[model samples]
Target: MSTPDIVLTRIDNRLVHGQVGVVWTSAIGANLLLVANDAAAKDELQQELMTATAETAGVGIRFWTLDKTISTIHKASARQHIFLVVKTPADVLTLVKGGVPITEVNVGNMHYSDGKEQISKKVYMDQADKDAINGLIDAGVKVYIKDVPEDKEQVLQKF
Candidate 1:
């Protein structure tokens, strides 16, 4: 199996919005947007919405369950440049553990919720989120927080 060229892997709660569909996709030169989220995959409406957004951005999009993504990602065409996006750090960690060659992760937008601490202006995390990110770092993944391509990359240190 040959894996597609993964240009960028990002953790953004808002799966395929303007920043992701237009800015990050264009910046990374990814022809395909692979959204690996279990909930999004099962939600037909969300898939349709995200697909529309990706189409407007002129990029192909796929919403797959984490299991499917892990099993089938390597089967993608080698010519395909994939930009993998997921909702959380734990998802990223799952993909990595499942044999996705994700060396670096861009922490984009993790919204505030109960029990979640504000790690940065645009990021909030609870204990599990922090542990997942820390695990990624320990696995030699270069995890950084950057909302957009133009923003400065903030390397995440284990907390």
Candidate 2:
């Protein structure tokens, strides 16, 4: 099975916003935006909104559950350059554990919430998030914190 080119795997709490739909999509040259989140896969309204955003950006979009993303991501044609976005590090871990070939992850916006520690300007993490990120690092994935394409990449380590 041949997998699509995963141009960027990003974790952003606000899934498909202006930065993602416009900036990241154009910057990465991704033909498809693959959203791997359980909540998003089942939410019709969210799907519609994100789909419209992708279309406006001149890209195709797919909302798939983590399991679906794992099983069928390889089915995409080689010409499909995919930008995979999820809400959390845990979801990225799930995709990695499920055998999706993710070697690098861009930490975008992990919102500040109760019980979460600020890791970067736009990123926060609790114990679970830390653990998931550590697991990814242990698995040989290069995890970095960067909100936008133009920003300098901060390698996340020992946080």
The model with the greatest lDDT is 2
lDDT of residue 124 for candidate 2: 93
Model 2 reaches what TM-score against the true structure?
0.98
Clashes of each: 0, 0
Query: Per-residue lDDT tens digits of candidate 2, residues 43-144?
Result: 999999998899989999999999999999989898899999999999999999999999999999999999999888899999999999999999899999
Off by over 4 Å in 1: none
lDDT of 1 by residue, 1-159 (tens): 886699999999998888899888999899999999999999999988888889988999999999999999999997789999999999999999999989999999999999999999999999999999999999999999998788899999998
- Model 1, position 32: C-alpha lDDT score: 98
What is the Å distance of residue 120 in model 1 from its true position?
Answer: 0.7
The segments of candidate 2 whose C-alpha lies over 4 angstroms from its true place after superposition are none
- lDDT for 132 (candidate 2): 96
Cα-based lDDT for every prediction: 0.94, 0.94
TM-score of each: 0.98, 0.98
